[model samples]
Target: MPKNAKKKRTQNYKKQIGQVPGALIYTGAKEGNKLHLHVFDYNNEDYKEGDLDSVEEAFRFKDSETVTWFNLNGLNFVNEIETIGNHYKLHPLILEDIVNTSQRPKIDTYQDYIFIVLKMMYYDDSEKIISEQVSLVLGKNYVLTFQEAEGDVFNSVRQRIKTKKGRIRSEGADYLLYALIDAIVDHYYAIIETMGNKIEDLEDDLFTGLTQEEIAQQIQNLKREVLKIRRAIFPLREIINRLEKNENGLIKEKTTHFFRDVYDHVIQVTETLDIYREMIWSLMDMYMTTISNKMNEVMKVLTIIATIFIPLTFIAGIYGMNFANMPELQYKYGYYIVWIVMIVVLVGMLVYFKRKKWL
Candidate 1:
């Protein structure tokens, strides 16, 4: 019975993990494709580079004193990641959270390490928004970062660590961890800046008398992007704030201030998102007003045309009858006289419309 229960449990776990085959994972590949591993070791005055094709190779040089940063670039692997976690004594729940990419930004503290997951969003070359999950594990002497795929925006931190510039090399792994997080939060500003530009463009288009349908579509598009960014940044703010106030020694007291800086950035992002949401609502209202005004103008023109032609049509219809006693038809200049009368009436109506300011 115990063996059967164990098999059932294993099957359930496998089923859950298999739901999203394209989801990001913390481990290296086993059957399909493997990810590249980058390891960086640094102290106050000494720094070393260790790039490996395998996760095992990256962890082989780990020491207790110096800070080691291991970056895993791909997440298609399962067994290799399990192996690495086994070597480091990582919590299984933390591994599960890292494998699930749709998780909200959160920080979980374990007995020996702290696990954090954040979403990194960028605009690709085709102007499409791309989002990837970034998982971070902070331990006593090392920081391990895992990404969905390669080509992240954290190259600046890597460069700083390599050059031993600033207080990065002198600080503990906690500070380096702070730097990595700060870097992620900093890139969020670029996205906000781009959104600001889009808002400005939308405002200009509206003022230039954009069509109602066009403005409505643009509002929908902008709102979607704003909501997407809001979803990505709001939880991140909570997560970073928690990290700032957390009493864990893994995040040093000195680095908590830097984490505060990240918290402030989150505040800015939240404000910007609110502003964009309001602007989209305003655009929606503007679209409705513009459409209504246009419809009113069309109806006004049609009413004026009908009003002017009503009398003229009556006069023509009376003269057009084939009655024998129609005296106006027998007159010598009847057709010319009717033309003059109609022209005079038409001009009078035009003058009245002009005076009423309805033209």
Candidate 2:
């Protein structure tokens, strides 16, 4: 069998294990308890924004001359999603991929539309990294974006469109798609910056003599988070590369340069992640070496004490023998003499150790 067919079979098998056929199963968090739709219709001369109650209402503007951006803020409503897919004539596989939420970043081009899947990442108020899937379906004159939850990383894009601040409002739907993707990519910089700060804090703690187990736990946590970010952003390079060289006419010629810019940003993010991962590994190794050296230092002190007492113990043991006619036992001051000799031997060993710098 061909590679694609085998992979498709595997995916189907996995999905079928606990899923009903033709069912829409949401695989993400339940934060987006309610469904909401925000539409932005614009052209070089006009712009409008509103909330739509149904997917049919959004489709009304699809045939208009202006470009329409349908932003669905939640994915838990499977029925509504299936309705929008049916109205747009979207393939079932694409719909399934959109709701899966665990999809790797990829692109799929069809006859009338181009589908792109990528992650939108951000740092929450507590400085924790959070990620969500953002899927874009680009048609001739409309761009449909399905987000995992109500909130998004597209506020800057919205501001630019509302204020007419950039060429976004002047360009076609392809440009709008680029603008939204760019917004998602730009927030990766913020996540990377947060990771960098964490790495620096870990390095500082390392010098301050933090506990090995504590620092090790922290390093592992940071490493895990970086791996997650890497998984999210690395495949995006290929996705944007395909968009930049798109020949299907779904992406406009003028907008390919904008995607190229986003591609460059993705490269930078990948490189930064690589650097941080290496630094975390180094921190782990440093932690281990410090622990080993501390243990060796303690052992050295113990070994020196044992070395000094060995001969003293031997002398005492020989005198402790209960043999008949022992000369030391017959002496009048044998105990005092043994005491003085042991003290002399101990002091001499201490002097030797101090001279050798082993103390």
TM-score of each: 0.87, 0.87
For residues 1-359, could you state the per-residue lDDT of candidate 1 as single tens digits? 67456432222244465545433343322324347788898899899886787777866655658899998866666666677777888877766666666667888887678889988887778655677778898888899987867778788898998887789999988898888888877777877788778777877777777774566767787888888878888887778777777776778787888888888888988898898799878877877877788899999999999999998998899888879998888899999999999999999999999999999
Worst lDDT run of 10 residues, candidate 2, spans 6-15
True-vs-predicted CA distance for residue 12, candidate 2, Å: 12
Which parts of model 2 have CA positions greater than 4 angstroms off?
Answer: 1-15, 18-23, 29-32, 44-46, 322-324, 327-333
Return the lDDT, model 1, position 349.
96
lDDT of 2 at 217: 72
What are the per-residue Cα lDDT tens digits for candidate 2 across 242-347?
A: 8887788888787898899998999999999999999999988888887888899999999999999999999999999978889889999999999999999999
RMSD of 1: 8.0
Largest lDDT belongs to which candidate? Answer: 2
- Quote the positional error of residue 168 for candidate 2 in Å: 1.7
- Hey, what RMSD does candidate 2 come out at? 6.4
| Count of clashes in candidate 1 | 3
Q: How accurate is candidate 2 locally (lDDT)?
A: 0.86
> Each prediction's Cα lDDT score?
0.79, 0.86
